[model samples]
Each structure stands twice: as C-alpha cells, then as structure tokens.
Target chain A: AQTVTQSQPEMSVQEAETVTLSCTYDTSESDYYLFWYKQPPSRQMILVIRQEAYKQQNATENRFSVNFQKAAKSFSLKISDSQLGDAAMYFCAYGSGAGSYQLTFGKGTKLSVIP
Target chain B: SQTIHQWPATLVQPVGSPLSLECTVEGTSNPNLYWYRQAAGRGLQLLFYSVGIGQISSEVPQNLSASRPQDRQFILSSKKLLLSDSGFYLCAWSSQPNQPQHFGDGTRLSIL
Candidate 1:
C-alpha cells in the first residue's frame, strides 16, 4: 500500500507572496502519479496539478507549480502570487500507474491567504 | 466534456434508518466510479470502487455497500445507518488510470 504524507497541518501567506506546501510519499512502484487537490468551503475537490513519476520535468499551471523530486519521493506545490481564492484545504494524493482507479490521499493542509 | 452528479445535496437520517445515495456520470463510457467518505480535517477514505456494471469492490468492511446498476450509475446503500456514518460522501470518476479524477459537489450525510 502506498501512503502520502503532508507534514504541514496549516500554512499561511500574505497576499501576492508565494507559498509552498510540502508532500512526500512512500511507494515501491516506480511507475506512479502524484496529484495535488484543493478543497474549498464548498467541499469540492479541485485538481491543482499532477506529476508523473517518470517525467523529470515539473508540472506547472499558471501560478501553481509542483517541485517533483522523484528520487526523494517529494512532490510539493508552490503557489505564487497567492490570491484570496487560494484559501482552502490542500491534499496530496497518490495513484498507481497499473490501471488502478484507487487514489490514496494525505491528511491535508489548511492554507490561509492573508490580505 | 464529462461530468459527475451526486445527490441529494444533504441528507439527514436517524440511527438505524435505511440510507441510499446515488451518483451518475454523463458524456463518458466505461468510466471508473468511486465512493469516498471524508471526515473533518482528514482526507478522503475510499469506501468502494467499480470498474463495470454489477462489479463492485469494497475497500473497508462496514455497514455500507455499493452497487452499479448501469454503466455510469453507482449507488451506495446501508441497511442500518450508524452515527459513525455521519460525514461528507463524495463520488468521483476517471476515464482510466493516470488520469485525474473529477468529483461531484458531494452529499453531506448527517446521522442523528
């Protein structure tokens, strides 16, 4: 079984600043995928970004970028120019590449954006 | 575009009551459907997942059970609800592995 760990329980950042949420996973499979999901007060899980274990290049989406260190098994999300809309509970999830539909998720980190 | 629908938006059931929740996906075929229960501050706990109609996989042993009547319709039911079942229930779908899952608005279940 694969496990995802988000060491940070809560993180805060000032408006326009950058914030990074830490995530690490333990998996024996070399082929897998990592994901970051954002859940706002509405409780909808929104896909922030995804990283493939085989791909060395990190993934980025607008202000959201992931520093994926495959060797260290660390995949962290960096939110630049943070906005108020970014306030939510962030989760780190792991998925197998062997055509499995199950996704293991971390406890989650609560992000607060201060104006 | 593919979308997932889960309902009712909120449910209130008394302990030992029967419970049912439905989820459907549109604009996609042969999707992998999943049911998850989320507790406050904790992440999602996968309850059940299905690959095809009439094929359901149970992750945790509990009073809950899941069924797939159609290609895209997934149902979660309980013969006798327990107070521990009070939490947010979410339905999600993915075309296959290595794809990001899309989630519905989710149903909040409260057992009194």
Candidate 2:
C-alpha cells in the first residue's frame, strides 16, 4: 500500500514571503503521479499542482511549485509571494500508474499567511 | 469542460438515521469517481472509488456504503449514521487513472 506523510502540522508565512510544505511517500511502484491539493475555509478541494514520476522536471503553477525527488520519495510544495488567499490546508497525494485512480493523501499541513 | 456536483451542500442527521449523499459529473463518460472524507483539519480519507457502473471498491469498513448506478453518478449511503461519520464529504472525478481529479464543493455532513 502507498502512504503519504506530511511532517508539518502547521506553517506560517508573512505576506509576500515564501513557504515550503514537505511531503514524503512510500510506494514500490516505479511509475506513479504526485499531487498537491488545497482546501480553504470554503471546503472546496482545489488542485494546486501535479507531477508525473517519469518527468524529471518539477511542476510549477503560478505561485505554487513542487520539488519532486523521486529517488528520495519526497515531494515538497513551495509557495512564493504568499498572499492571504494561500492560507489553507495543503495535502500531498500519490497515485499509481496501474489504473489506480485512488489517491493516498498525507495528514495535511495547515498554512497561514500572516498579513 | 467537466464539472462535478454534490448535494445537498450541507446535511444534518440524527444518530441511527439513514443517510444518502449524491455526486454527479457532467461532460464526461466512463470517468472514475471517488468519495473522500475530511475530518476538520485532517487530510482526505478515501472511502470508496468506482471505475465503472456497478463496480465499487471500498477502502474502509464502516457504517457507510457506496453505489454507482449511472456512468457519471455515485452515491454514498448508510443505513444508520454514526457520530464518527461527521465530516466534509468530497466527490471527485478523473478522466483516467493517474490523471488529476476535479472535485466538487463537497457536503458538510453533521451527525448528531
């Protein structure tokens, strides 16, 4: 079974600063996908970024980026120029390439942007 | 564009009462559907996933069950609700395995 771990329970960043949320996963499959999702107070689960295992390049979406180290099984999310809207619960997820649509999610890290 | 809808937006039920939550996707066919629950500040816990009609997979044994009667519709049901069942229920859909899933606003289920 695949499991995702988020070490940080809560993180705080100043407005316009940068913050990183760490994530690690345990999986035996060689091919898979990783994702970062955001949920605000509205409780809407939003896709922040995604990274394919086969890709060596990291994934970046606007102010959000991921440092994906496949060998280390670590996928960390970085938020630059953080705004108040960035405050939410961030979750790291893992999915296998073998037609397993289910995503194993980390415990989640609550991000707070201090204005 | 594809969109997923889950209703009702919020639900409150008494303990031992029957519960039903519905999820439907639009502009897609044969897509994979999933049900997840989030407890307060915790991460999503996958409850069930369906690959096709009448094909359902359970990830945890609890007071809940899921069914897929239509290609793009998924339903979560429980004969008797429990206090542990209170959480934000999310419905998501993906075109294929390993693809990014789009989620609905989710249903806030409160079991009293």
By summed lDDT, which 10 consecutive residues of candidate 1 chain A come out lowest?
A95-104
Q: What is the C-alpha lDDT of each candidate?
A: 0.95, 0.94
Docking class of 2: high
Please write out the lDDT profile of model 2 over residues A20-102, one tens digit for every residue: 99999999999999999998889898999999999999999999999999999999999999999999999899999897878
Separately for all candidates shown, the number of backbone clashes (residues 3 or more apart, or on different chains) is 0, 0
DockQ of 2: 0.87
**Fnat across every predicted model, in order:** 0.78, 0.93
Instruction: Estimate the TM-score for candidate 1.
Output: 0.98
Write down the lDDT that model 2 would get. Answer: 0.94
- What TM-score does model 2 achieve against the real structure? 0.97
